[model samples]
Target: MRRRNQVRQSVAVSAALLAALFVLPLLVVAPFRTALFGRETPVDETEGQPFVSGQLDGESALRVLDGETVLEMDLGEYLLGVVRAEMPASFHPEALKAQAVAARTYTLYKLQTGGNHGDAADICTNPTCCQAYIGEERARANWGENAGAYEKKIEEAVAGTDGQVILYGGVPILAVFHSSSAGLTRAAGEVW
Candidate 1:
């Protein structure tokens, strides 16, 4: 009887230890999900998937707004208007009609990048590679007409818009949200 009790206790202890080892991974996975979402959140099943976090929001998504009428738009075209709107008014149709390089000083896509840091004309070493567009944080020029509180609102939400903006290869692409009247698009999405 004593031997049987010892064996039973030993088995229980081993089972408990095994269960803890397995559950340890579940605990670790918890933080990964938390980091992805930033918090525990329930998603709205009626709308769509809930966006979990900020970094994932800007990963390749877009936010849109309607001037007055509501409409769905392409992610690519929307982001272009943002980059353009976020740009100085110099990027307006009037200026877009002129040489893209005309307004150099305030222009977001200036031909020269200014000084490397109080040195020489900040010419790009590989303009053909990156197309040499420079901004302190891309540009305030990149934010656009629609105002969104969170980057997640730009992504998995905002199913409707006046327009939208998308990111490709870590670059912004803006396109037209033509609700029978088209908006903006670009050749390169980022450069043009």
Candidate 2:
């Protein structure tokens, strides 16, 4: 009986030590992980007022290149396509709004700096080159039954922050964004 009790206690201690080996690393890293990748609270500048359209009424149209063709479209209309393609419509309205602003700012920056396509167009539909774009028909097809609702959400997002752009030193900033990062965020100079 004494030998059996000693074996049981030794087994229990071994089990506990194995559990700690697995759990301790998680406990130590959790705080650092949260600090590195915490969610940022977005600021609401609209003061809870409902979004009103027509804010982009007087803006110049955008010249977008689609493959071999150059298409002219209203700035807001183009942003609708960009936002829809760049972000999931299921995202929160505020997130969609932020995407719209970022797309608009990026477009404006490209215009000011003379885009890589030379005189062909202001921007391209290819996401690798510029922002992604999806026509209403294609977007609706992709959304299937949720087409109308999703399009309406994207439209509201674009119209809600119409004409808004991120600026630095009184000029529109690049406002670049990516869906994911490789462990750490890299600066423009580092990537470019």
Candidate 3:
């Protein structure tokens, strides 16, 4: 009977140690996650106000590299194209709005960081390099019968979230996003 009791205690202790091995890291890391990843600033701190970083204001023109040519266009116009290309027009308006904010924040971050193209432009049209973009004509051609409705939908999404951006530490974050995750997504730290 005493031997059975000792075995039960040993099993309990081993189970506890095994559990601790998994739980302890989460407990220790949870409190520091925000500190390590940076937290979003409170909305009250910046509510109703457009984020202006350095000389990059909401109305500032953006220089984009489309193929070998450089084109300068309004920030809103650029985001319209980015939203049209980066996300499907069939998505919900709210989702498109979120994408707009992320794309805007990313564009601002690139501008602040001196983007990959250096001197050539603030951003590029390549999805791999920066973000994908499709002009109104291309988007219309692709939409076919849904052109008018899709255009209106995309325009509303872009215009509705105009000047809004996701900010961290009072600055725009990189705001990377993907269209699909291939059934599973990995944490940023795991990939980077």
Candidate 4:
């Protein structure tokens, strides 16, 4: 029937338009997002950064949950806060431990390399962020502990200090996008 054909055409057009609205913008935006994050991806590649800006980065900012402003926490503080005091017994202890280590390690790299002082605006970093931005070749070389071996030919960056870190500004050793199999935030000291 003509009605059926019209319906099919309507659905087809709707799908086409939806694809354009969604996929077209992504095509334009994804590379831009990578550039902003100090990374790049070919269209042929499957992986990519989803959002561009540091402020409205959506799930990327979820690591700093309920955070309207930045918090500066060092590794010693983080270790004492998250690892020594606050981890939950319900979670897989190894995974949680790994996250804690990653969070502390990455924070140090960020603080040392992002700038020499605490006054600059926060950089775009999260668990999924590339290791190059943290500006540490040492983190790449320390894969047994840092776990950045998957990264190929990491970009070189200047190391400014031995005590580089802040809770949100630091980089994580294990760089998966999602948080964990148990889905929980670390205790206040761990991340704050």
Model 2 shows how many backbone clashes? Answer: 0
Off by over 4 Å in 3: 1-58
* lDDT by residue for model 1 (82-102), tens: 323333333334333221212
lDDT for each residue of candidate 3 in 1-192, tens digit (9 for 90 to 100): 999999999999999999999999999999999897896433232222332222233467889999999998878888888999999999998999899889989999999999999888989999999999998777776777677777777777777877888889999998999999889999899989
lDDT of 2 by residue, 112-142 (tens): 9999888778889999999999987677777
After superposing all C-alphas onto the true structure, candidate 1 shows an RMSD in angstroms of 18.9
Worst 10 residues of 1 by lDDT: 99-108
How many angstroms is residue 32 displaced in model 1 relative to the true structure, after the best TM-score fit?
2.6
Model 1: CA > 4 A from native: 34-192
Please provide TM-scores, in order, for all candidate models, with all chains considered together.
0.20, 0.69, 0.69, 0.24
Which clashing pairs does model 3 show?
none
Model 3 residue 172 lDDT score:
90
